[model samples]
Target: MIFIPLWQRLLVALATVAAILLALPNMFYGRVEVANDARASIAQGLTSPELEADAGLWPSWLPSGLINLGLDLRGGAHLLAEVQVSDVYASRMDSLWPVIRDALAADRDTVGFVTREDGPPSELHVRISKPEGAARALEIVRGLARPVASLSGGGSSDIEVRAQNDLLIVNLSEAERAATDDRTVQQALEIVRRRIDEVGTREPTILRQGADRILVQVPGVGSAQEVKDIIGTTAQLTFQPVVQRTSNKDADPGAGNILVPSVDEPGVYYILDRAAVVTGEDLTDAQPTFDQNGRPAVSFRFDPQGARAFGEYTGAHIGEPFAIVLDNEVISAPVIQSAIPGGSGIITGQFTPEESTDLAVLLRAGALPAELTFLEERTIGPELGADSIQAGKNAAYAAAVMVVLFMIASYGVFGAIACVALAINIVMIFASLSLLGATLTLPGIAGIVLTMGQAVDANVLIYERMREELRRGASPVKAVQEGFDKAFSAILDANVTTFIIAAIMFFVGTGTVRGFAVTLAMGVVTTMITGVYVSRVLIALWFARTRPKTIVV
Candidate 1:
């Protein structure tokens, strides 16, 4: 039978148990309580949007205020989004172009110029009287191009492209030297949060670091698909024609006699509008407040045109009600009690503080250009998450029992050595996760189970090799050495492929896929170490002293 030194074996067994204990507690997350002040510190920089985006970020359900569950353990939704930076860059460039245009046109004497007049967002055409002088004018526009160095990739390569002649071409990066900072991933995170604000989330946590990838955490949200819809779609708000408002025909302040078209179903409402007078583009802020009659309501303010139209409409209508609608649904209708002079006013109606707060959040985040449909939805309650975790644990325990029994029964003593090392590999995986602050998802657990199987894969190869060497009449030491040597390449290639797949999962996949990918990656790495290397060391030391010839065979 395979014989092992007691001291070495005991040391490994203890280490394995300790690693499991450290990682076991984190499998489920619930609540933690702390002093109010500590909780307050944790609450720092946590805004409504932040809290709504990440329910975990706030000490909402946790009275202890200590630890919270991640999506993996707690069973929350995960989202993946491919961000587009072109729109944001084009917008910023468009805004700055006006300032540049004014500055250049002001110094007309410096260089004679003819405006291309009509040009795309980034493309400008100009005919200069003195072609040589156009370069100086170009310098002014070029001076304004600081190259948006942001955390998101959108603005990183964000340089102002100067086309030949008097034309200013604003292509991102044509040269080999591209600026870096705000990677597309960071931009996506921020943009997604903003969009979530527009739609209002239960609570989400979005963090950004990578160039093209972002991490989004949503607690208590069951629908990954719904979250994706809200965050993924770019709600390009526009002012369309109001064929009907919620109420009857009314005159808008600026346009005179404004009519917004709308149809109300049992619970669902739709406002069919042609063109909009003013959309969310001019909206600045919206808040909930008590009107003059102490009625719960919301107050909104618009930018220049929005303000002017609002003011003129309210002033002229005097008694008619103006509708505050969102996504074609009428939120509130408040009558013109008095003239709203400054482009800011309040909407008084039947609304809870929560509803008002939600409305305010939506407006502040901006609105969708048109209506949206829920293509898909799925919900996972906390109970379901608990059940899933329990089921996973049970399965793991069963699998471990079966694998351990099989390994020892088949190979006798050498098989038992592999089992012990395999156990250590599992423990090491958990320990590493705890240390790394990685969440153990259900998929992650599956990854671990799969890893447990693969953990033995390397050992099996080496053990088989050693057995073959012994049959061929090689010395025990030479068999062991040659077995490890021969199996190295195969293990390397197989594990490397798995590692690459995990990397891809981290990049393209979101939420659960990512969790599985992470655990798989970590397990693969540790399996190589503990399963292949660590197990060999322990076996090597034992064989050196005992010098067993026909080991447990």
Candidate 2:
């Protein structure tokens, strides 16, 4: 330990210097964050002269990473939402009506007239005029069963269509329901992530909870209500062919048609075909742009198949009006002036620039599979977070001071060396956190304070071993070497056991506990480096230059 080679010593020194440099950004986090944001904006062509100046505040080559503060530290919104996954079941059965009707109508001889039977919302019940035809109807419907393509229920049929008495019931099978529930939750999670990211929030925590719930924690957001508004809109966009345009609010729109109120004109309603010509799922991209009238509008491009279908529909119905519906409200009804062969079109409405931008974002993100009910919500104030941060800083300083004073009083010059190593260890911890983009919470700060004591444990063992060696009349260099060698087993064993525990906590814990685990895990690795290798290098250099024959312990 006392005789570290020049190459190894230089490598350790360079690494320590690099870690300190990487951690420097955290000291000026506000400026660095502004600079980083400006740089990103410039990349997106949203740059102005003011933003470019901000970008110059921090050089691009420097380490721009900063430790992300968790919701607890930064003060933001927390929301727990329960997804209504079963709601999709009713719609699924309703959509199967066309397929079932078409299939049975093809074999009309024995099936006779097929009418939908009023039954459970979870099931599709259709009665055949001829009871004897139930078996044949079941066979036709069962032929429509699709293989479940899911991780949970792979290679199984997605639906079960069976004959019960005079009625044929169609519903999702057990395996299929499990698969559907999983998919609904996954899609909801992705949609929520996209919506939040679209709003430009940093480091939002969105994760699945239980079977049909989501936990969202967005730091730096103003309120839980703001986040809820962004994600809760549903924003289901669809294009339907207009059957009739009317001024009557209470007019019967006929079966298979829906009466939707116009968004700009409150009293006017449009009766649109129940089946959609295209949906937002077909959209490939959407951007806020000016229309031909120089008004704010949203232009959307479609995927290949959607583009083909849309182009054909418009080409065939040149002079007919189509309603652009959003969440059951008609945003606009415009006649197809000509065939849009390029698969892109613009949506014009009485929209401001902000509204157009938000709608574009919603279109690009896609729709949620199911509606979410906010079960719990809370907004944390910045004042409380500031207080917590101040308290954490005080605790850390007190711990560092006490540890440093104790080390100085006990081990003299060796204690001073240990203190330097401890300081380097703290820098390394922050560097690691920043590099990993880990969120720092209050509990994580507590972990740092705890690590302050642990950082010097190896030094304590080494110094005591050195005293023992000196008592045996060993030379200073030999005593240092034996001290490090003897304490190696104890240091390695203690750190490894604690590291295992930290790993367990990191894997099993959630939220604050996981944050604590992250800091503790990082601290353990940094402690091993600074307390063992760094301290050894510093002492080795001192001994090599001094060539001391004997030393007081």
The TM-score values for the models, in the order shown, are 0.52, 0.93
Instruction: List runs of model 1 lying over 4 Å from the truth.
Output: 1-22, 31-257, 260-279, 282-351, 380-387, 431-444, 469-478, 501-518, 540-553
Kindly provide the TM-score of model 2 when superposed on the true structure, using C-alpha atoms: 0.93
What is the lDDT for 341 in model 2? 76
Candidate 1 structure quality by residue, lDDT tens digits, 1-553 = 2344677667666766667665554443332212333344446754454334444433444322122345645656754443443444444443444465576777777756445334554444444455666678777666666544543334443455464665555444532122322433454455568866555343465755344445566655666766765565443333332334333344442211224333233343324332344566677887878878876777778888888866676677677655555554455555668867697766554677887776666666665322223333345667877888788999899989988888887777777888878878887887777666566678888898999889888888888888889899987777878888899899989999999999999888866787789889998898887776678767876777687765642
- The TM-score leader among the candidates is 2
Tens digits of per-residue lDDT, candidate 2, 1-553, equal 2668889899889979889888999999899999999999999989689999999999888999999998988899999999999987876776787788889999999888887766676898888888888888888998999988777787789889878777888999888888888889999999999999998998998988899999999999889999998999888888899999899999988655678999998788999876677888899999999998899999999999889989999999999998999998999898999998788998999999999999999889998878999999999988888888999999999999999999999988889999999999999999999999999999999999989999899899999999999999888888898999999889989999989999999888878888899999899999999989999998887777777777766
Q: After TM-score superposition, what is the CA distance of residue 438 in candidate 1 from its true location, in Å? A: 6.0
| lDDT score of residue 6 within candidate 2 | 84
What are the clashing pairs of model 2?
none
Judge candidate 1 at residue 338 and give its lDDT. 82
